[model samples]
Target: MKEKATLIVVGTPTKILDSYEKQHAPFTKYKFHLSKVYKGDGEEGTEIELLQDGNKDASYNVHPLMEVGEKYILFLERSSTGALIMVGGPAAKYKYNKEEKVFESIDGGRIDEHLERK
Candidate 1:
């Protein structure tokens, strides 16, 4: 079964939990795709709604890493490892809107994926 992400938050660039040392996370954003929201797993992110292009690549232009509405809000800051860290409040959260038959990202994620992309 396919699922969709619920919450996509853009928090200050922080270190993603990795082995060895605690360095800043690579991605410019801290996207929270809740399993509960997508009915998926911890490994693969929640299944995103496919674009009209028929592409199934996990990576998409609508990467929540990109700031929404404004540009400065999601700008990236270089980390020690050259990884881009996010700044500002991209902190988004969401719930499954069963009534609408789609995931609703409170912050950013679930939406008109079939029609929109960054």
Candidate 2:
């Protein structure tokens, strides 16, 4: 999945910027402060905006949204409008387990083997 992404980075969500419908689908824009760049050209501390599928309300969302201040490793690609989006929706986003010092898939899938290769 990382191979198909234009940008892959570890970052913390700073804020939820907006929630709007795009092409009839609800989407939310998030502001993330980069903490590490695993692949692609992003600098640590750089703030990047990510357009994720779903709205602010979790009840209507198919995928879970990023929680503010939580660290995440994201696999992203540029959309048609040049906005960064998760390459595989919920599958490509991983949340960091601070105590365990490892990342766990947001959707509850096991991806440690894949991450170990990095």
Candidate 3:
């Protein structure tokens, strides 16, 4: 999964910026504030827009969506339109557990164990 990702970062989802249809599928744009850059070109404290594959109203959208203010470790790739997207859908998103100081899989996908720590 890491091999396929163009960008890998730890960040918090700040807001849902927009929702729109692309190529007949629903897409959502999110405002993400970067806290760390494990792999890729992003700088800490930078805010980047991430595109997800579904909107809030899409019934068939099975990918786990990022909640506002929740911290996450994201594995992303660039879309053809030059937007960043999760590399493996829900599998690429891991929510940070502040109390436990660990990363929990949002959809049962296992990421590198080493990445679970700061």
lDDT of 3: 0.82
Worst 10 residues of 1 by lDDT: 47-56
Q: Which residue pairs show backbone clashes in model 1? A: 10-90, 14-25, 15-24, 15-25, 92-107, 93-106, 93-107, 94-106
Cα lDDT of all candidates, in order? Answer: 0.28, 0.81, 0.82
Q: For each candidate, what TM-score against the reference?
A: 0.21, 0.86, 0.86
Q: Write the per-residue lDDT of candidate 2 for residues 1-118, one digit (tens) a residue.
A: 9689888888899999998886788888999999888788888989999988888653234468788999888899999899999997887888887776778885565444236732
Candidate 2, residue 14: CA error in Å? 0.3
User: Could you give candidate 1's per-residue lDDT for residues 1-118 as a string of tens digits?
Assistant: 0212222222222222222213332322233221222222222333221111112222235334322222111222334454433222232222234466443442555543222222
Clashes per prediction? 8, 0, 0
Error of 2 at 17 (Å): 1.0
Which ranges in model 3 have alpha carbons more than 4 Å from their true place?
59-61, 110-113, 116-118
Q: Highest lDDT: which candidate?
A: 3
Off by over 4 Å in 2: 58-62, 110-114
Model 2, CA-based lDDT: 0.81
Worst ten-residue run, lDDT, model 3?
109-118
| TM-score of candidate 2 against the unseen true structure | 0.86
